[model samples]
Target: MTENLKVEVVGLNRVKGKHLVAQIRLSNTGTEKHLSWAGEMADRTRPLGEIKWASGIGVLDAQARTWLLPYKPAGSPCLCSDRERDGLGQFINPGQSINVYAVLPAPSGNPATAIVVTPLAPPMLNVPISDEAPAGDFPDPDAEPVTLVNRRLILPAEALDKSEETADDGKDLQVNLSSDVLFAVGKADLTASANSIMARTARLIDASASTTVTVAGHADSSGNDAINEPLSLRRAQAVERALSALLTRSEISFQTQGYGSRRPLYSNDSDEGKRRNRRVTVTFAKPAPATREPVATTPPSVTGLTGTSKAEGQPIAMEIAGLRRLPGGLGLLTYEITNQGSAEARFAELHHAQDWEAYKYQAASNVRVTDVAAGRQYLPGRLEVPTDDGVDSYCACTDVSGIRINTEKFAPSQTREFFNLIALPETPGTLKVKIGPFRELDVPVQ
Candidate 1:
């Protein structure tokens, strides 16, 4: 194991015929920033378990078994890493440990013999370019980068189906519960359906390999931050209480936080948007297994669970997630709007792929801009939803309105997020952004 990065391979379990789950721990020994994909977009990093023989170099073992994919397929058990929040890889802080939940495929071989790991080289740091070149622009060509060694393992022949004492991997899992099921408007008390929602959520939490659980509450922008923040936190605590009572495992850690009117799933302008905005996001981080340990027991729910698909609907909502006037002359508006309604809503044209913004009622029509003094109206900016991660989701769109959904149908209870980069028209002073007939926000200029 290199001092820079140490990988501990605790155990290997066969999920099925040719697929396997590798439990690994990656630790940072040096002070230099170790790269993973946590803060980065999904497109930046390659999937963990995928191996391409055509490339000639990837993770392979003497047993002839190879890992081929990074995602947990339909039949695979719901691992905490599988349910983790967005971002690939991660950047581990010094003295930090990150668990990785990886899926791999094998043709046929005994992986119990020896497990080897070949991690991609760390990302190169960017050096600023001057008129000519920076002093350190060129690195020593003869320099040899450090190599990451794998943790060796030996599992019994029948270790495929049984639960091991050690659950390896250090990735966080995320599951969102509809706030509509938890509370009513202007209230923080748990609704009757709150029990049902928690029941489902607790099951998902209890079933995983994660030891730490964080419940974060969010509310619609209906109210100001003052009222929304505490209410949001209170809602989260309510959830924490339920989990404390229901989940009997003392080893599993639990905590809560509240972001009032902060992170909305949908626009707060419409009822549906507001409904979806009020939500609780539960995050679970998989516990890295101790070497030679086998999972003694799993939650009772793990065996009875079916399946959960988190990618579904979207709605253009009223609440603004972010609003910034860019340096050049344009403005960037980030917002969340999801279909909390019982049905799907169309805000764009599927046939008009090139004309993504074409709609009978353009969200641009619903947009309004006012000067700092509130005395003038400026030219409205066209809406363009941010597209860092493209549509692999059930329903999808980047449009702020008429977000054409249905690939997953704006199922009665689903939410998606979007941002708009609008032409700000070089407005001076503060600007009031009004979307639809409802939401009005103030953006100050420097």
Candidate 2:
């Protein structure tokens, strides 16, 4: 139960055998007052009837590590409950149970289940997908379902540092090495550490089924193409030569290209983003799938540790419940916060953490998941949203506003829960979850 409301995820069904539709039943059990859907559930960034619709609703594809948002056809509104069009108004009356729905892009690869994500409630995990049509008219009956190309990140089990990382979209795998670590500034010659990076990359290639490897180089937005394009190509050539020497398979071939800031993984607005944009990437086909057990479901019980947060100058207790692997390729980190004192407590320390600084909104975006055995840390999952100007990235985690807690003045003895979505490792193991100002908890990825 979240904020005196009970939520039931009915099912995710296929519409026209192309689009995926999700139906959720929301019941208002709180006797105090009516609930505002927009204030609590809608994604604040949306344009129309934001408060009246669940436009921010998302479906988490665990296997692809992607968040599928409500899809809308060109020049049309989001395929969700219309503003004031449905019988329910901006608010849900007390003791009233209503059903809200959203149309999302059907996930590729035909996943068996998806994690339903709403603002205030605990994630509806492993909700089975059905072939039956939903009970009402489609949100946009005339519009056709178009497949949108989504960007996927390869969550690595082991990492050397922030300078080198890898991400995959379940199909192709990419190993991204920062140019600063691979070469001298403005030069294409391999640096001292390049050999070790290439050796590690060679091992990954040796295990892959692909015989042709593509090495691509990218530059930051600092210089023009004349200076960047040739330099990037040279960098790719250098990486190709090193890989050819280190790789054991003699028949494997290499293809190289230079993209001079034409493609970027992150926005170039900040220094960190710019540094990440300047990179050399090796792309190849992932190895064939092996027979493995189905993705595990989270346990129904709650068990965790509680600690105080003195950094916020308030008597608040932070509890890290546990980390459990969910069906599909993700993990759910459950936690809660309690205000112990009479005065209201604000989570300033948590909102200002380094990991969440980029996201100014009030959410549990600061949490980090560390694979204990692999010695690698991961942030919350990210999804790219197409905007008018370009694409924007957001953390695929819980937004605290959906939970019934005052952002500034958390009442005395008030406790609020949070659910964060994170990408899981290829193999199940123990995980270390770091919540705000709380000691890290050792949680098994069961």
Candidate 3:
């Protein structure tokens, strides 16, 4: 019965932006009444600050268990606020038997250690309370129990670092992609364009000579779990087949699972939210070392820039890189951009083929960039070219240059721009476009 004093993490739920909440249950199997008990949350992989008495229930009915203690844990400050700790609550009881709960907020690092739930101490009554009891007379409180539950909650795209080591052991890699890329309204079939995009991903896996690929499917909460789970699984399988054909490497293995509506990317109460929850992910497993040449890596060059005009009057810039030549005299370029000025900017337009030839005019699109932190780096954005007959005109791009520097509330300083200009095979060295206060630099098509 002493084994019941042990605590276990019974459930883990991940919230948006890398925040997580864990439900822990502690039971008292000892025959003697306990005066007090406390537990601490610790991580071996990384430093986890004290959670204190996150949550706990004092009383226990002999073999009885206390209520679950729920705790919030996150991977970054950008994901949530440190002030969230203020909303946390605690509970405590003594004697008979009880269960306890805790809320733990994680720090901004990907922790690799197991979360340990350790008991603080048994009851020590100073006023000769009825709950205090001798250790040996009651059951040994430190005994380990077999039915305890301990599980970890990992965020999507959070397991990439462990991919290589766990690839061959059937270990799992959990990734959550923006649902916007994987599904259409109420549809399970893979979009032809989506297939095309994932084809490149499959080629990468094949090039790595991976042994197996696992695709996990997920859906939003628009429907019941019964319907969403099977649907998600089907979506996963569909991706596996498409990827298999694209890579044309049959030696690689595959598996698919459906998580159903149990896990959602966003709140499904809104259409936009539901759309963000439908997604399928692909994880690759590396094969044993073999006599195969390493995949070739070529640094991509900057080719061209897709230009646009903004009504906001704020200066805008785009940086392009990873330029490569395509079949039809077309070029490809990818680059990173940033808003260096005080004002916000966005992707406003692109020059299409017909528009390019007819009026030497640029077709316009609307995109906005905001949340310009004083100093912070962001992921790079990509752009492709040879204009897709106006079909694939818009691509989301991020602002990443710091050319604009000014203290004035309305005026912007010098706005630096970056762009990869893709052009026809014979198009001179490079083309340049000046829209608003930003200069668009196009590189020679490689």
Candidate 4:
């Protein structure tokens, strides 16, 4: 064993996407001797069995026998199956020293303390990065820059299939639940109806035995920020507590955050819109294992909408979802409308482009409808001229009389469904589909 060979951690940093970086230095105490050291880094705050090797190279010194190394840290219960573990492989010549550096993902608020630097012969001297000085003072112009091999391990949302299966790999998996299942009217507390839904979520974590879980709560724009922010957080924490109780595994970790109206699933102008915006989502990640290769899978689906309404005396709103591509070159766009205030909402006027003041509609254009229920789909008898370029395109409805269509008494929770055939413009870019006065759905027509 080389008595002069000493290992020290000099710097550490936490990065976005839950990654950690550490810089280390190895030095020789003897005046004329060489040494070599190698080991793995572990975080005690995380699951004990979930540690992996980091990216980057090992450093060595030929004279004064010193070295510096850098390494990335990994979370626990790695999901990637394709990673490899290579122990230290080098020898230090007399009077030489070296340094090493690394980067990895770790739990928030918890620092890593399981770094074991072995000299192969006892007298191991591995010091934390905080206790050491900066290595920048010693410049080595001729030293070759260490190249980092950037590799990512992605875990699919469906990977948590077994009860005892824990995701210790440093891979990320995200799943979003429908807003309809997350909240009740004007309330932040979890509804009794949502207990089963939360139970399923708890099972997901328990099955995966994840090292960490982050739950983010969000609300619609129906209320002011002051009332919504804390409400969102409380909702998130509620879910967190539910999951914690269901998952009895003490090794599992958790975190909670609230975004309030900052992130909305839908606009808050209508009751249905507000219902779709209140939601809580949980994201889980596991520490990666050494000597494992990551598997490949398709990306998850994302859904959202953008809305705009015409300047008609009454408010107009539209909500659309399940926006997916069709077999032919044509795309499918579906939406629902609602009349909240006490007023008759005539679809016929909407068909003639009277509600919209921005875009001009050509007279006598053939706007065909493929499907419509009795009395629900009505057309305004008169045709209106297009006023500007921003007005939403209009389609002909069968009914012409401006009668009260869907809502009888202008109740607060009235809803109507409408379908339109949109011949996508020849141009490329995002197509903004206006639903009503307060809601619009933006679909990308690539």
RMSD for all candidates, in order, please: 24.2, 4.1, 21.3, 26.5
Greater lDDT among 3 and 4 belongs to 4
Per-candidate clashes come to: 40, 5, 54, 81
TM-score for predicted model 1 compared with the true structure: 0.32
* Per-residue lDDT over 1-446 for candidate 2, one digit per residue giving the tens place of the 0 to 100 score: 24666677876897666678888777788884766655466654455345566766667666666666677666445677754777677666789877888888776667667677776666777778887877777665345764453434334432637667766556677888889899999999999988878898888888888889999999999989999999999999999999898888778998999998898876688887888889999988765444566655655344556677752456888887667766545577777777788776676545544531354246667777887666567766555556788755555555544333455456778777776767677676566777777787766665
Q: How do the residues 38-110 of candidate 4 rate in per-residue lDDT, one tens digit apiece?
A: 3223211123243332222222211111122232223312211112332333444555555554543332233
lDDT of 3 at 272: 52
Best by lDDT: 2
Give per-residue lDDT, candidate 2, residue 174: 81
Candidates sorted by TM-score, best first: 2, 1, 3, 4
Estimate candidate 1's alpha-carbon lDDT, on a 0 to 1 scale. 0.43
> What C-alpha lDDT values do all the predictions have?
0.43, 0.70, 0.37, 0.40
lDDT of 3 by residue, 390-446 (tens): 211111121111111121112233332222212222332433323223454444434
Worst 10 residues of 3 by lDDT: 59-68
Span of ten consecutive residues with least summed lDDT in model 1: 156-165
Better of 2 and 3 by lDDT: 2
